[model samples]
Target: MTRPPLLEIQDLRTYFYSRAKEAFIRSVDGVSLAIAPGETLGVVGESGSGKSVTALSILGLVGGNPGVITGAVHFAGGNGASGPRNLLADLERYVSLTKHDGRIVAVAKDEPGWRAHVERALARVRGKQIAMIFQNPKSSLNPFVTVGQQISEAVRLHTGVTHASEAKERALGWLERVRMDSPRLRFDQYPDGLSGGMCQRAMIAMALASEPSLLIADEPTTGLDATIQSRIVALLAELKSEFGVTTLLITHDIRVVSRLADTVAVMYGATVMEHGPARDVLAPGVEPKHPYTSALLASLPSTQTNGRRHAVDGRLPVIRGEVVDTMNVPRGCRFHARCDRITDAIRARCMGEEPALATVAAGHRMRCHLHPGEARGG
Candidate 1:
């Protein structure tokens, strides 16, 4: 049998509840994704399209108290485990059996015994098995501490390098691996002391210091110049190959996804609009099945006139009306309000039934009403 994917997310729903429980902001709604070992999956979308939330949900980092997450995220390669299983599986059984980086761990958004499970899971995997490089190095890095100290801490913690000298040495080695110049000297400098590119490199060093199996890079090139962005992208590509790591790259830059991703998932209005191989779905000549995906590609500068850009008409619909209730989400199609292709007759039908993601071709799927006989409306 073919091995299960390294990670599998099924119908994930993450909603934020108001204090009185009177309202819900459905940040992530029915998002499903899967990634094989050593493969890269790129999630592309505009801001507030639930891309970050999806990543955070996977890591069990979505906030709590007011936030409630309900979903199944199955991860493989945990300790002696042979295949993937839900992280939210029976708490007691999961903790006793699922080991990651030499520790039994269970991480969930919210559940009984969730705190203990999440803390242990994070301690073992956050820096060791699953590393994350955030969008902003400044926010991620501690301004008061020297860069070397931070990197060394993670190296020592995850690798059991008890001696400070050895930890610093490992940190320096990681810095060099990320192609940061003069690694040893840069180690002692604080976050404020390094340039944007250098600081980002330092962040990468810290994240990679533990030799993680999976890396979550959330817009790692967000603030860098085009030149620096290209360098970072190249560096990530190199590291991914060297480490044989599975990567979940979240970004708004279609160019970056096209260049680095093996698979691309286009998300909008808190839902995935299209998913397929990066090369085939993002090819210049091919028209995407989903209107949102097409509009997004058309809006890119390279696809525009002169230096001007193409803009999608109207605005992204307020998902499920403006009520923010999961039960009250728009009557039929959530994206129909902004979809320019909706006809008067089709609009009436679409407004009554939500379209499920249907296969458009081999290895390609899209969520849209105009998919002809493949309509999954109910």
Candidate 2:
């Protein structure tokens, strides 16, 4: 029997009330993704393109009572697509705690059990099943706590290791696994005591302490020096290979994706315009149908300083008005506002009609009126 996907997310939307704009932000507007076990999926996008929010939404992290998240996020237990291991079915069971006015909203209908379930899921997502190594280790890690304690705390909660001693041992072992020599000494050191690379390694070690099946690393190597960044990404690749773990590598670095991703998903605005095999997504002309993807390929800085660096034209085109509201995202193509293709006559239609995602190739999906397939038939 075939097993279920390691993790599958379908049309996931996460909206947040924007205090600055007084409108809900389409942070994780509509996203669908699937990953096989042991595959590294690279999510590439600009800073505000909703990559991090999508990751947080997956673990139900974004703090909001009425914070609506509508979609499915499923995880498999070393099972292929045919298996019954679906996180969506038991999705609420994996989501973090939700309390409105001190009243628990959903989770088995009971107040206490609901709270317990919420706590458990929070502990699980932040605990075992999924681990997130954030972009900034300094802010994420506590200065007072020893690196070992932080990791040990997670391991102790997620696993059945009752004794603190066992948790510490496991945590130290993880530190060693991340290739931190003399882990025992480093484990007792505070976050501030370690160098940037060591701190990053400690963070990774902490994140993996629970042996999570899925690791969501958000720009894990950003902010670090080039040499350190290279080492960090290498460390993660090694871990992924050795443990047979699935990873969601979130970054805007095309080069990083080239190095680590087995599959690359390009995020433009709140939608995924194009995606496919890692190499295919990076391929020139014949492959990428979206102008955005083509632009991204073109925008990549060339190795040799062939004249002054030139960025994509037109200031990244900030949608020329206000960011679209999640509550009222325009009908057709979400990218049409900033899109240069749609003509004046049909621009209204492109802005008004909703375009569902369609496959142009065997495993590739794109939602655009520009596809030749749509032009030929209809």
| Number of the predicted model whose lDDT against the real structure is largest | 1
Runs of candidate 2 exceeding 4 Å displacement = 1-3, 20-22, 78-117, 120-125, 163-166, 283-287, 304-331, 341-349, 372-378
Candidate 2 TM-score versus the reference: 0.79
Candidate 2: tens digits of C-alpha lDDT, residues 1-378: 033467788877666656664455767767888777788889987777788888887775666533434567776643244553434344344345355654223322223443444456454455577888988777788999998899899888777787999999999899999999789999888989887888889888888887787888989998888898999988988887798678999998877887888888888667676766676676433445665665565566556343323444633323333434454566667677767667887776777775666666656666677763445332
Per-candidate local distance difference test? 0.75, 0.71
List the candidates' TM-scores in order. Answer: 0.83, 0.79
Candidates in order: C-alpha RMSD to true structure: 7.0, 6.2
What is the lDDT, from 0 to 100, of the residue 11 in candidate 1? Answer: 79
Off by over 4 Å in 1: 1-3, 18-21, 90-113, 303-328, 372-378
lDDT of 1 by residue, 28-71 (tens): 87898878788899999888778898888777787664233456
Candidate 1: which pairs clash? Answer: 320-330
